[model samples]
Target: MSGTAELAIDAAFAARLFDELAARTGDAPGITRAAYGEGEQIAHDMMIREAQALGLTHRIDPAGNLYLTYEGRDPALKPWVVGSHLDSVPHGGNFDGAAGVIAGLCAVRALIEAGLRPRRSITVMAIRAEESNWFPLSYLGSRAALGLLPAESLSTPRSDTGLSLRAHMSRLGLDPARVGVGQVHLDPAELHGFIELHIEQGPVLEAAQVPVGFVTGIAGSFRYRAARILGEWGHSGAVPRGHRHDAVFALADLITALDRLWGEVLEGGESATITFGEIGTDPALHGFSKVPGEAGFCLDVRSPSPACLERIHAGLLHIVAGIEAARGVRFNLGARSGSAPARLDEALRARLAAVAEGCGAGFTELASGAGHDTAVFANAGVPAALVFLRNQNGSHNPDEAMEMADFAVGADILARLLARDDND
Candidate 1:
């Protein structure tokens, strides 16, 4: 087969692998490849098998990240890493994390078939535990691999299994002691660059009729994981209009105020989003006859602009204070998890754009509202960027969909990008 034909065949094979992995891990609901669990481990083994089939060497880092290496002319030079995570949220769609890794695999295969050697090694990495659904944490693998995770977080227990992250890693034969100690971390200075290919997980690309998008930046976000409001319980029917302090009412008022604040922020020519995903009243303390005495809720606010996030957060604080006084309730909101926005490396972005144009593919520039492993690497001082393939039905569900043609286009771009020399 000609080199171009061989590359095309590999790209098709990568797309098929997505179907096989998804079928193996999940069925009716969606993908259930939880981090350090049986399903995820199965997926990782498949990745390693594919790497070996392609004549690449594979190894697992201390944080449980998998790296498949293609040797270059100079072994000592830093590697150009291309990959994404293999784990998924419960019932999440197949393409969320797996597409990038598959694309990297195809890209490396294409380079090998063409018999091209660059100055630095090329590695296809399968990062671990990127979804926050299972562990109440995002970027678990990438952060630990970069030594950016807080040392104390290793022993923190998870909500689902009551097992700390360290325990989970130990169960999987990864040493927790090596995490954050520079022993398991990928040094920033030792990386030539990083690129990740992913499904858009939103409507932007599909709406624009574009096959791919060059990400300008990833949004920063703040989470109020365990926010509580306290008020005195009272008889629901007997209390006068001004006599009772209802925690549920207070929470309603706060939500309304935040909605209005969101509009104000949008009017100010900045992009931002806020979500109150979970809320509830204490089950044991309340009934239909009594006013709710305590309420708990979670909040998530995101923006590509740091200034916009600050402004929206300030508005939230002001709204909380007003609601507390007006409704006679106490508010206790604490920080849970957050990371700042990450801008893509400009030089690498230009190369991706050029490759897309050369392939005669339609493209656009956009900002990713959802966070990805690329942002983590970018924030850690590695030159990083992301390419988003058009996807529909959003993500984190069984209905998520993307065209195989789009996937092939993205894989081609990645192949061309990886094969290019810096001076070329």
Candidate 2:
């Protein structure tokens, strides 16, 4: 096939893969491909087959990360790795990780079809357990790859669910003892670069009438769990409103204030988001006697800029201080997840931007507010950049959608980028 014909064919295959996984949304919510679930394995199987068909060798690391390598003409240069993760949030969109995986596969296919091997090796990864809702360790695959995970992590118990992560490793017929096997040793400048193509997962691309976006930086995240204040539990009529500390009542006030802070953060010229996701209280507030004990809620904040994040952090401290004084209640706060801001490899980003323009695709630049495996690599000092495909209206929701044509366009851009010289 001609060069143009080959690019078109591989791009079409990527689009088909998106449709195949996206159509699996059963009902009521977004994707449920939590770590090591059936859905996750299905996605992995398809990717393996696709890689095998294209004549690439595949290996599943002890961490469930799938690496597919295609030999290049030159054996001396470090491999050029292109990929993203495959696991999704509880109800995440299909294009988030799957699109990146298929796009890399397509890019390699396009290159091979053109019969042009690179000056370096090409490795494609479909990392596992990035969502981390079920597992305590987020970025499970990348951590294993970089040897960033501690030995204690392997022995950490899973949630109430029967699937312990180490058990999952064993089921795959791999030894958990080999969990951090290949990651320990690495050359600082070893990898030419790592690139990820993912859905924008926000409305920016579609709103701007663009097809692709580049990541200039990635946001830092702060996940906090805070306890609420509660007054004594008594008969509804027995105690006066002023006398009760009602933990839920106090929590309700904080929730509303934080909700309002979200809008304020957006107006301050920073891409920031806050989610007050989970809440719990003591005693059954429903049925018979209203048992009242302690009530707590989780809060998460994200911002693409480090300076902006610090501002938000300061504002949060102010809010917490005020609550402590006015309510006479201690504001218990602790972080469950937090990561410093990450900047993309500028040279790598320039390369992709040039390729996007060459493909004649409308493009825009953006900072990723969502965390991913790419962010993890950058954290580990591996130079990395991201290409974000346009996300339809919804992303983490079950109704998440994106145009197939956009996927095809993104594949073309990735192929062009991979076909370029890294050290150039």
Indicate the TM-score of model 2.
0.88
TM-score of 1: 0.95
TM-scores of all predicted structures: 0.95, 0.88
**Of the candidates shown, which would achieve the greatest TM-score relative to the real structure?**
1
lDDT of 2 by residue, 222-333 (tens): 7774445544455565666666546566666677777677788777655888887788775445324453435778777888777766777777778777765665456667
What is the number of backbone collisions in each predicted candidate, taken in the order shown? 0, 8
Candidate 2: regions farther than 4 A off: 1-6, 22-30, 155-163, 180-188, 225-231, 256-271, 280-292, 306-318, 321-325, 328-335, 422-424
User: Total backbone clashes of model 1?
Assistant: 0
Taking every candidate in turn, the Cα RMSD to the unseen true structure, in Å, is 2.1, 3.2
Give, for candidate 2, the lowest lDDT window spanning 10 residues: 1-10
